[model samples]
Target: MKLNERSVAHYATSDSPADHTGFLRLWGGLGTPPTAGGAGRRCWFVLKGNLLFSFESPEGRAPLSLVVLEGCTVELAEAPVPEEFAFAIRFDAPGVRPYLLAADGPAAQEAWVKVLSRASFSYMRLVVRELESQLRDARQSLALHRRSPWKAGATGRSKPQASEHSSRLENGHSPSKDCSPGGSVEGRGSRLSGWASAEWELPGPASLLLGRGQSPVSPETSCFSTLHDWYGQEILELRRRWLQRAQGGRPARENKDRP
Candidate 1:
């Protein structure tokens, strides 16, 4: 219906009657239909539904009588036309043979062709929009159901008890019931690796006992090694004294000879 107004504005002069039920009358020079001998004279054109109608104006009285065209199809002209006529549009319909109609100007021809073509396709557009709306609603319903929690009581089954973690929190106890003296499973790897890394990074003096560097003989090794060796010798000497006391302080050669 909106296309009717556009067609009238572009193709019709100041005086023309138009509506939705009746055909839209556009004044233009009519070319000869395929059955005609030569180019036709100026006339008025109208399109109602799938039919096209042409009317010739009588000299004194209003135009009457109608030539109806059906299975109507409209298209723009491929080549340029004579100057006497503006740009042309070709109409091919079922009952009638194809004919070339000339508009008053090129702009008018373009508007007539575009508006009519779009009008034909508008119904398909509405159907597509309705389908898209239904599809969107279906997806929203599915997602809402998926995100909602299930109601177990609806199945006539008793509800599950709270997990240990939830029970601990409810009773004001820490939620680490399964944790050992060390830590939780998630943190164990990081904790062990951190302790080993810190142990390796101890001061040079502590490296000797930990055996972190190359060898104990390295000159650049910690000076604490000398103290460590002194303590080692003192420990060996005290052990020898204790063993001698256990043996009643007997001389080694005397004991061997007696045995």
Candidate 2:
């Protein structure tokens, strides 16, 4: 049951009441979830199982139903809408979220929003957790080669590590010492760039740059190399843990392969 004053939206699959229209008629702003809150109206229409979840609300507010389906979209035409009812996936989250598809007034909307918000929150956490798992695996693969270059000598790795991009980093390579042009590598990246960033102290971009005498080349080049090497190690370590976990956290697996 939806409210009379407020219009609820949904994917085509949802069971909208006979009085309510299943087809969406929008006025503006939608496609994907906003990276951050922004101005203007934005909405997300999702199809889950047989239910169509049309998630909307003010952007960036508390009780945020900030998580939803990431999918391809179909746009709709603009129409007259309530000023406060505009969908916001921009800079803000929805207010008192998880508003339902029931036919009721403000109270129903409030209850529905809360219910859905909690569900979305849970999902958001899972995604973050999954990321942690993958990163751990990639980091470990990198470390194995780093510690025993001779064993991994058959595997070729020549390029510097991409600080944030683990997929591109070499998993099979010589040890870190062998790759060194000479000296300590200090890698710095914003701790805030990923799931942990929001919860941790992120180093500035300059942290990725070389500091003091830690230079084998020009300051700019040295900084780049140092950052690269530092991040390279981090990548290895993270992947190492991930791989260990995947293999069931066994010490024996750590010693296997590459030779």
Name the lDDT value of residue 241 in candidate 2: 60
Instruction: For model 2, state the Cα shift of residue 112 in Å.
Output: 6.4
Per-model TM-score on C-alpha atoms: 0.29, 0.21
- Model number with the top TM-score: 1
The ten-residue window of minimal lDDT in model 1 covers 172-181
For model 2, what is the alpha-carbon lDDT of residue 24?
Answer: 22
CA lDDT for candidate 2 = 0.31
Q: What would the per-residue lDDT of candidate 2 be over residues 1-259, giving only the tens digit for each residue? A: 3332222232232344321112122333334332333323333434332233444532312221212322211111112433232221211234422121221233333332222222222223334333443554565476565665232432333232243234213222211122121222122111111221211122311122223323223232235576477557546755766676587764664457424
C-alpha RMSD in Å of predicted model 2 compared with the true structure: 19.4
Model 2 earns a TM-score of 0.21
lDDT of 1 by residue, 1-259 (tens): 2345444334332234432122222323343333342333555555443233444532213233232222233444422334322222233433443355555655555444433332322222223333433443463365446422122112221111123223223322111211111332131112212111221232322233235544322222134675466346545654665587588985675345441
